[model samples]
Target: MQEALRLNKPVLAICRGMQILNVAMGGTLIQDILELWGGSIKHFREELPEHMPAHTVDLCGEKITEIMGKEKIDVNSFHHQAIDRLGTGLLCTGISPDKIIETVEAPGYFWVIGVQWHPELMFNYFEEQHNLFKSLVTKCLENMP
Candidate 1:
């Protein structure tokens, strides 16, 4: 992630990938979002259903909203840890109802976005989620030699 970021390469990190990106960029994680944020809604829910629209992530900034084509998106969550202190140059693109970091991006760079949800899992059931994959692939292809 650091190398890709240094080279301004196109990359999309998901869930724990986002956590790794944060740690690589001198940021921190909640460790256990469930235990730390137990007061909030059941973010670490178990056995509800696979690929169900779990929570709404309110997207911020014109870039993310434009890419997602909405101010908010329903995403399926599956991780216990999340970003706490944001990575350097990475902006908080979206957040959950309980204020968990749902999306992030490296501003002034190429496609270096990260999301806490599994858009790949949701892409089959929800057509809107496919845009995330499409966006990543499009960016990657654009940067290819």
Candidate 2:
């Protein structure tokens, strides 16, 4: 990841990958979101139906809103840890109703998109989820040297 970022390569991080991205960039994780929220938010939907939408993440940051073309997106949640401090050049793109950072993007890179949810699972049901990959590929192709 360090090499990719240094080379300005497109990077798409999902779930724990997002966490790792943050750590690599000198950021920190919340460790346990449930403990912080004190069980208020339904962030970890292990008991809910697999396909059921867990929450809505508002695409507030400029890059993600432009890529996703929507103010908000319904996503499947399955995370207990989250980015506590955004890394250098990183911006909080999406936020859940509970104020959790759901998405982060590094504007300095050619393409660096990190999401707390598992888009691969949600893509089977949601077109927008799949579009995330399409956007990454499109940007990558456009940035190819």
Model 1 C-alpha lDDT per residue in residues 57-126, reported as the tens digit of each score = 9998666677788887988878888898987777898999999999988877877788898888888887
lDDT of each: 0.83, 0.86
Model 2: CA > 4 A from native: none
Show the lowest summed lDDT stretch of 10 residues, model 2.
Answer: 34-43
Error of 1 at 59 (Å): 0.4
- After best superposition, candidate 2 residue 115: deviation in angstroms? 0.5
- In the order shown, the candidates' Cα RMSDs to the true structure are 1.3, 1.4
Candidate 2 C-alpha lDDT tens digits along 15-77: 899988888898998989888765667788999766678999998877778777899999888
Q: How close is every model to the real structure, measured as TM-score?
A: 0.93, 0.92
- The TM-score between candidate 2 and the true structure equals 0.92
